[model samples]
Target: MGIIDFFVNLLKDPRGFIAGWIVALGPIWVYTPLFLIVFVETGLVFFPFLPGDSLLFAAGVFSADGGGLNLWATLIVFYLAAVLGNTSNYWIARLFGSRIIDSGKVKALTPERMAKLDHFFERYGGLTIVITRFMPFFRTFAPFIAGTGHMNFAKFTFFNVIGGVTWVSLFVLVGYFFGGVPFVQEHFEVIVLGIVAVSVAPAFIGVIKAAMNGRKGKGGE
Candidate 1:
């Protein structure tokens, strides 16, 4: 199959794909692509649509079921991928943020959203990095905003590590414990979608809250 078809299949059933990969490619060979998926999802701003939470959960399930991927190694690889992804994203923002914003070539970086994120970073300071890690689209954007805003590297690194480790551990552990349940196994793709929905819900709520608050402030004025 072509590249697009290949990724579509993988995204459609990441759990099965990972399991098959483990069986076919073995533990050692599977790490690179897995790591790159997690890394590119966050590290490259243009590719946030890549599956992050489901992939981790699926990896956990594969590892738990005596698949080729070991439990501890899965966690470590994913955690590092996440951490390094954010770090790379931040540096990319620092280096090319203004040019990207000014050029307006990328459709995702809308002015209003960037302003909101800028305000978010300013309002929450360093913790935004940690908080957004569990939230889908925002998680990718938070570090970029931090970099664009010139947030201190030390502070960014501190929270980046915490967020990366926590996020990876949570989903992976969830998958290990619950992913192989009979119901879940039968309906794995639906569950993966559910996971993504739940992960993105917080950021969605936050956006709604902010919008409501903005309206209230306007009414008051």
Candidate 2:
């Protein structure tokens, strides 16, 4: 398939994508692309749309018994990718976040989204890093915002690790334990979409709330 078609397939059905890679790249090398996907999704502020939660769940499904991937290895690769990804994003923002924000180059970081993140930071403090780990777009942006706001590096690291470990472990283990069910096997695509919806729901809700609050503030003024 062409590159665009390949990614379209990957986004549409991550399980099939992982299965294809497992066969094509063998059990060992498949982890490379998986690593890169998770890394880029979390690391690059511009690429938040990449599938992170579904990808991990799909990887977990493959890592199950007789599924051709080593459970431990899959976990380790994802853990490292997630942690290192956030660290790089953090530093990138620390050094250049202001310029990036001012340039209006990243369409992903909309004013509504930024307001939501600011609310998260103000309410959760360092724990915002951990909380946003389960959130898709926010996960990618939280570290960058933290860096731009001059949050303590040590605090960010602590929460980043916690969030990474918790987020990866929860989704992967859920798939590992339940992905083999007959219903899941038959309706894997639907299930993947469900995962995406559930994962994105919180961020969606937060954005709506932020918009409403913005309107209320304007009314008050």
Model 1 ranges with Cα > 4 A deviation: 1-8, 206-221
TM-scores of all candidate predictions against the true structure: 0.89, 0.95
| TM-score of model 2 vs. true structure | 0.95
Clashes of 2: 0
Residue-level lDDT for 80 in candidate 2: 98
10 residues in a row with least lDDT, candidate 1: 106-115
| Model 1: per-residue Cα lDDT over 147-209, one tens digit each | 886498899999999999999999999888887799988999999888888987876786788
What is the overall TM-score of model 1 with all chains considered together?
0.89
For residue 19, give model 2's deviation from the true position in Å. 0.9
